[model samples]
Target: KIQRQMGSSYHPEVTMKIQVPFEEFTLQIEGRADGVMETDEGTVIDEIKGVFKNLDAMKEPVQVHLAQAKCYAFIYGE
Candidate 1:
């Protein structure tokens, strides 16, 4: 439902595999986002989740969810 509202530009279940090379500690991040949308603005990662009636009770994003979104944004070079 969320994906539909975002528009057809958003592809469902987009997977991202990014590798960051460092001096010694290399980083490899891989995950599948609910969907990804691209526009004149930039790339947007959608991290969709369900929590029953709890969705209405929340006014702001959860810390972990926010962090995950940030990580995806970083990987996407947004």
Candidate 2:
């Protein structure tokens, strides 16, 4: 995937089927990031999205994308 290819520069790896336990139950979260990029600055979580329309049409979807990215960031501790 795009992330994997980009992460090759930083020797990135993928984490699959990550479980987050809560008080009531556990949430099963799955992700296949483009790749994890490590640099002198810090670790970067890459999320790739393909949209075939104007930004207006994609606003709602973009919000979802950002939410997913935020989750990924939280999971990765970035």
lDDT of each: 0.81, 0.71
Q: List model 1 lDDT by residue over 1-78, tens digit each.
A: 766887878888877778888899888988888888998898878897766667678899888988888887887773
lDDT for residue 75 in candidate 1, whole number 0-100:
76
TM-scores, all candidates, are 0.70, 0.64
In candidate 2, position 74 carries an lDDT of 79
CA-only RMSD, every prediction: 3.0, 3.8
Candidate 2's residue-wise lDDT over 1-78, tens digit each?
A: 654656555444466356878999998997766667777798887777887788776536668889888887777773
Error of 1 at 59 (Å): 4.1
List pairs with backbone clashes in candidate 2.
3-34, 4-34
Error of 1 at 36 (Å): 0.7
Identify the candidate with maximal TM-score.
1
Error of 2 at 52 (Å): 1.1
Worst 10 residues of 1 by lDDT: 48-57
Q: After superposition, how far is residue 23 of candidate 2 from its true place, in Å?
A: 3.3
